[model samples]
Target chain A: MLERSHIQSTGFRNVGPVGERTGFELRLRQANYRGTRLSLIEGVTITVDGVLYPAAHNLVRIGSRVYTPAELDAATETRLAVGEYMTVIVPRPGGLAPGVHWVESAIGYRHPYFPPAHQSAVARDARHATIVMA
Target chain B: MTGFRYGVSLYSYTDDLGTVMTLDDAFDHVADTGATGLEILGETSVPLYPEPPAAWLDHWFAQLERYQLEPTNFACWVDTRIQLDRKLTVAEGAEQIALDLRLAHRLGFKFIRPKFGVIDYNLTPDPIWEGAVERNLDLAQALGIIILPEIHAPTPIHHPVTEGYIAFIERTGTRNFGLMLDTGIFQDRPLTAWGGGDIEAIRKDAPDMVNGIKVPVEHLDDIIRYVPFIQAKFHHVDEDLHDHQIPWERIVPRLKALGYAGYLSSEYEGVRDPWVAIEQVRRQHALIRRLEAEWEAQHA
Candidate 1:
């Protein structure tokens, strides 16, 4: 099982004090609990408040590899080593008079045992972050 | 000798994980019921799994020593879909399994319940599950941990997945892999007081939700050897210590007749009210103890 843990909004900074644009990074560790490595070819999805942002669309930095939307979509299958973790940075766009916000992220992919065209299932984790728009 | 050993799953008191009860409290509760074994849900019980620090591991073992509890199973997940876009390769899946195996071994557990990725809500195995299991068979043997796929409710023992698992075991001749039969399947009816929904709606849905696709009690004989433990899944226990849904009277004796020696871990997947759940577990243990004595006498 690829378990998602330690999900937190690490750093938040304001682009403008009037809240023209807000930026934050959601830091999480995706740990592979299965006896094997996994690939993130399908891309990840991050939902802030109720807005859905695909990893392919957002900038994601794992290790030293920074993936653009087009690159994440076109990247080959890179396996995540078992028991090893990939620290993921999901760049979030923010516009808020915020007291608290909820973030949910999930990666949807088919199991190797699943047949072709079968609906993929998701490994999901969520966290609540109290944000102060200072 | 009676073929069954009694135990309680810490999952029964999950409502108290970080609140009312700590892991120490859970061990005390299990010991109070005269159960020597404990089944721990790795995700909830272990704080930072696969890499918990030495201090945490020491505390875990200390609790076990204090309560004289044996770790029976470390229930975990095998997520093939950790990535958003692609499935893990066979080797990758094996790596995840090996990781859990190492953790389970380190924690002194002999059994690991790995929930393989499912295709349906009923937890139908993905077609490649055999390959996943096959790939890890060696590691499982080396780690000395048996991987038991939970045959939970709504998924009958006769389901194609169960059959496939049985075939896989036969084909591979591996002793490190087995089945963990959940007693939820023997539930003959739906729970009346299950976390208040529309009583009528629950009543209608309960049958299909709990017992609709159960493995018949008779089928237990055919698969008894493969089963190392039974998750005695219960929702409610009455004043008389009787479960309204599962037919324990019939099932317990059958297990004895088959000479099945395994832990019957009380897995209370009921409401989150801890005190009531504790009482319910106590009553369930009473029922199991009574049945064990009765069955032993009859056979003797």
Candidate 2:
């Protein structure tokens, strides 16, 4: 079962190696009431400790596949169903000093059903998550 | 006199379904309200959707039998704008409906509400909707189902969008198609909290959606014959049994006057604060049932 909030706390960690960390990743449960095709997700922006990482710089991983912002616009076969979460990979060399940090995510969604002006909806969430290991 | 049938759409439990509440918990909540019908979203409520495991299917029937609720409407999506650059063709749309029709039959649902994607802000469905639905008339009839596209708010009962639907029913003379009334259209007051989506942006771009379109209740008399089900969409009902948004007082009388004996499925789009919908749904049932009782007393 996923958490109630859009931003999940369990999947918060740094990737690559101990000394030469490549980046950090966090999970986000789909915020919409219904699951959307991957193409419908415009982008997901990540911000940590006030440092910003725009949606373009973040790569989303759903299941075993990773997708860029442009790829997400064309990937129609993939779906993040209700109660499912995807990990947002933000590239930041040497990650963060192993500790608790304030993290936020802004996910842009293009729902064709919504009116033209309101089609691009952004779901934002912020919370404190701990990176246990360096 | 025949009174209205009461039910609840699983949509009322939007945020809490997967978090704090389970499917069993939802059944308990609705049955406790004395509602005899249960409405569910095909994609949202059905695990694995189009193809749930046999075990889940067994569990679904078991839940229905135990809760003493009958399946009402199977809510679905046409997704006309399937991708950013492309839209689904009429054939694809027909296939979508056919798939849901079969699934709804398996789940013992009488109605399927396919929310077709819109062409513009007026929420006019794509042109392919007609052709798509035209092809599924036989299948819907065979399965004993009615395809109901909701007459929701911001899109009033008199708009060209609704006229198009009525025209289709008149032109084809098919009993398998009808309009599902979403009571939100008759909302005469402003909504404080919208449970659907981004509220502030909706208020700025489409004020009619948030501020209410205020379609008159008398309009129900215009097309009540074409309507067989109503989604009781409401935002808030206070501790004192007062609905702050939708005006059921005017609407209920019109429905009763029309001799409509269909389900009033609670479609709660309100504050997503966990269990607030449970009590709000109960309040709506109480308030609407009281109005029905009052109408019966007057006539009898």
The fnat scores of all predictions, in order, read 0.08, 0.58
Per-residue lDDT, model 1, residue B136, is 84
lDDT of 2 by residue, A11-58 (tens): 999998889999999999988887677888989999999999999889
TM-score of 2: 0.97
- The residue ranges of model 2 lying beyond 4 angstroms of the native Cα positions read none
* Tens digits of lDDT, candidate 2, B12-50: 999888778888899999999999999999888787778
lDDT string for model 1 (B1-300, tens) is 845788898778754555456667778889999998988867667765557789999998998899988899998766655545555577776776778788889999989988776666556765556777788889889888899988876678888778878888999999999999988878777665553222444344344554435457989988888998889988887899787778888888888888888899998766655467688899998988799789899778
- Report, for every candidate in turn, its global Cα lDDT versus the true structure: 0.69, 0.90
- The root-mean-square deviation over C-alpha atoms between each candidate and the true structure, in angstroms, is 6.7, 1.3
Give model 1's TM-score versus the native structure. Answer: 0.71
lDDT of 2: 0.90
